[model samples]
Target: MASLPEGALMQRAAAGLAYAVIGHLRGRGLGGVYGKRVVLLVGSGDNGGDALYAGAILARRGVQVEAWLLADRAHSGGVAALRAAGGGVVKLSEGYRSLSGSQPSVVVDGIVGIGGKPGLRPDAEEALAMLAGVPVVSVDTPSGVCVDTGEIDGAHVTADLTVTFGSHKPCHLLDPAASACGTVQLVDIGLRLPKPVIESLEAADVADLVPRPAPDGHKYTRGVVGLRVGSATYPGAALLAVSGANTGLAGMVRYVGTASEWVKRHNPEVVGDGQAQAWVVGSGSADGANSALAFARASGVPLVIDADSLRALNGPLGVPAILTPHAGELAALIREDRGDVEARPLHYARLAAKRFDAVVLLKGRRTTIASPDPDTPVRVNTTGTSWLATAGSGDVLGGLIGSLLAAGLAPIDAASAGAWLHGTAATLASAGGPVTASGVAAAIPAVIRSLPAVSS
Candidate 1:
């Protein structure tokens, strides 16, 4: 509406969608749209209007367009346009059995729009079930997906293509629902929308955010990330966490644990305990995790909380911090069921961030980074393969994020950028094979080097 007259924008949406549908049908070896079977699931609102008009355009070219009105009424003008162009309309009750026999070339889902809630009505569900195998193109958003939250409560349309206007919605960037939107295409209808609240960082963005050393810089001057992790019982945790901190994101790494000598043996550059710009605690701190976290918190600098340390700080973090936890750990932290958190990551992650007033980095194949502010958009990282879910992978991530924090980035930037790098490293290290946590940590420097350099 900002760019064109009220009705004109809708027309542009219809035209662009029509082209996409035609292209899809042609790709499927349907020859062309002419005389092909096209079915539309139409609601009563503007969503129905877009589908009705697009169907009308295809109908004029000899496509057999049949629109099933799911609502009590149809878009009057749109219905008239379709009838004028030789398209047929029927109620949903009359659609199911007929569509099952037609072998539709494509199905257009226009039963719901962005503002509608999650899950489909029973009639809509039955209609979708009747034409289960047919290709579906959604208007604006897939029917029944929560456009803002990406949280699905019940049945929803899994679209083969989603043609949106203005810009992509939260569902396009978020997961669960994102998985349902097969391929998304943005159609420019000359409408200028507001700035996107959520975003995912790419390689170039990471390169820009990474701290560069000055010519006059010394090791400490650049930044030192100190680790107060590990125990006699689990010394390997300190080694893995130190491995992550040694990615060269920070100038220097420090260790303050029972495995100080052991950590230095693995990476000699890592020195004994000392003051650091930032601290990473709890990875393997075991029984002493609570004491170590208290010590780090007393330093009054930012810290990365992971593993045992996370268990230590069960209450509000009370300091500038990054909270890294996998699904099970995050579930424990919030006292929610593990299966529930796994099912709804964004919901639980945001809850943790707001509850603790810190940056929460929920670890998974599709990692979610949420800031403490309620209005800030959450970032989703889809960089690594499923194989990256191996054990000790998160300890490496905690240290890497700690290094970024010591380098003076805000908690959110530090957490998100570190996650991006960590995931990218896993992908590079894997090379189509299984990769261990140490191998992923070892690959970090190469990933950093491969990134696009910032122009002076």
Candidate 2:
């Protein structure tokens, strides 16, 4: 803002806000923008100023715009511009009685912005309660959310759409706060930002990261992934893990477990035992998890550790590895409460990554992959449906990531890209319905096919 002329940034923000509100108006089929009622819940800061300026632009387009000032004072220049553009201005205190039966087509929530704390004032709450069912367009972020923590502490506006400038905030990606922000639209405001320490992968990023086969590649050249998973007590775990690895990401899969007969019965192509570039251990090896982990460690190759194998950790494994754990397993490893781990996944995941000297993939709605290197950014995956919380899913994830590791990707890249593919496969399998772990595994090839093809 210091680089630009005074009010230039504000003008750009107002124009973007106006454009988004107009889009909502057209999308709703609300008699086109002209003469539609739009009420601005103006507060006492630059947030209110942005709304007032946007209201002025709408008023010039023949919109019936009104500014309801939540505080005794508001942006002086914004108020002047609104009045000049023939928009109505009134203090909410003076007009509270007249708002009972009045209904505006849209409400612009300029009541709070990124600078505000995590709750609302009494009067702001009352205004929101009065206008309960109307569609809202929040400027920047929804009011009354912890801007940096993605937590909702008190009464807040649930916007139908949120218009953010420059970049996305934490509330846009994490849960609770993410649920409140219905659809986020980011507008470029021409600010050069520093490199971020947190990021979410889009399809293109995954496309570039996933390894492809060479035209002349033979079976051994492509790479082989081995599994030391499952037991007689949980044979299904072995089958599911093999299902994930056989999706053709790796050249071949080798199974060595108590459930070898069952795995071969389900997946005939899997070999009994052989050398491998990477190993997946401990999904359901039960009492044998420790031995399985030790055997895989002896190979001096990359490993994907999950389920029962997660408890076998004493220190760093002295090899490239990825640790897959849910909130409960992570809690046990760190000696913290499961609820605490869930609430603060970023902190705990980073801590575990540093402690274990490996990539830690913590599973949740927004699955976070934290790298052991301090300079590497934490990757957050924003795909998949809630239906993915089915049984044996983590087994499939473990095998899939192990395959990527065997194919020569770094541990962090393999883990993040594998996670992105896992979630996306679950979404495609679910299709707004219930999905099984087997169905998710089956959908992996289709998901890979959907990605843009890049040269090997």
Candidate 3:
């Protein structure tokens, strides 16, 4: 929750960059910039000004600095300072040849900032092609990435290191563009932007949000989670989901399915069928529509709709609920409700949340959680690894969230906290290798323990 005033934040960012550059040089065993060569690709915005001003600092330190202006308009004061500090400027043109043979030690990309358009300008593209293979550092965000949407249109610069001001933007956390951003370094710039349009949950943040057991708390007080999943054909789903809920987060788990034998075999503690505070419905229960619908009408518990259950829904689901859908499922939902919803995830998530009057957790590389009210801030989960894409993982996630909901966390908090824990557990279990659904479930306790302490 730490923040800084707008202008002061920018200055701090510049200072951080100065220190980083100095450190990089020192680590390379270079005495100083007295004889090193640096090239800067300058644009027309504050991004250019940042690089220009930083260049002035390097110029004073004896680095031979050259600024290649890509736009007719440039940062006036920054250019003046660089020139006064003995830096030279040149208008970028086709006359420049390949720098592959004599590449500068470093290149600064200042083409676009946060206000950049979706694609690069013509001249910017040509300049980048000319400087191919040069080690470059991007300011703010990589030029040409969809700053607000995290979408990459056409092409964008791939930086060796990105010096971002303030906190990370969506593009730095989401994929495609995220992959393009190499080692990101945050610079404290003094800008106080509004609450972020998106946010990544950190360990400390999760620690504060997760609930703890009290001395007086009992199994019933902790709350019961009803699970309506699995079938004769795919009983494994029931076991996996139940295993995921066994992390001591839920007081009791109740099973309702034809796969009761399998569920009991795996988790004998589960009740045969009973009332519950929350329900995890559908995971490998393809033919369980009848039972699911019956449970839906009979159970007053908050529900998590997933996999087959999402497809089985017929009318307005009459209860507090959360829908967990990936791109394909979301696309299908959009087709059923709104035509172009999937094209814009934020819009679709908000719309779905409102239409269903329930919390919606849209699963993806960067999971997004939205509430029924548009004004409420959306939560983005950032703790995942690609290993989470394994089969049966979604079922585990459903049970974990259902457990939190049963434990009395609000729908939004339950979904978001469950997602954060699921992702963190996946990362810990994977250890940079392939992991099974059971591994992720097993790691939940460790992840919970790693969270910062909070009194019940």
lDDT of 1 by residue, 274-311 (tens): 88999999997889999999999999899899988788
Q: How well does candidate 2 match the true structure in TM-score terms?
A: 0.93
Model 1, CA-based lDDT: 0.88
* Cα lDDT, all candidates: 0.88, 0.90, 0.80
TM-score of each: 0.90, 0.93, 0.89
Query: What TM-score does candidate 3 reach?
Result: 0.89
CA shift of 400, model 1, Å: 1.3
**For residues 1-456, could you state the per-residue lDDT of candidate 2 as single tens digits?**
587999988889999999999999998987689888899999999989999999999999999888999988999989999999999899886556656655788999999899999989999998888778999999999999887767777888899999998888878776667778888999898877778777888888999987788889977887899999999889999999999898998988999999888889888889978799999999988999999999999999999999999998978999999999999999999899998888677788899999999999999988889999999988888889999999999999999999999988999999999999999999999999999999999999999999986755
Best by TM-score: 2
**Runs in model 2 lying further than 4 Å from the true structure:** 1-4
Q: What number of backbone clashes does candidate 3 have, counting pairs of residues 3 or more apart or in separate chains?
A: 8
Off by over 4 Å in 3: 1-10, 21-36, 61-64, 98-101, 314-316, 336-343
Error of 2 at 261 (Å): 1.6
Against the hidden true structure, what lDDT does model 2 obtain? Answer: 0.90
Positional deviation of residue 185's Cα in model 3 after best superposition, in angstroms? 2.5
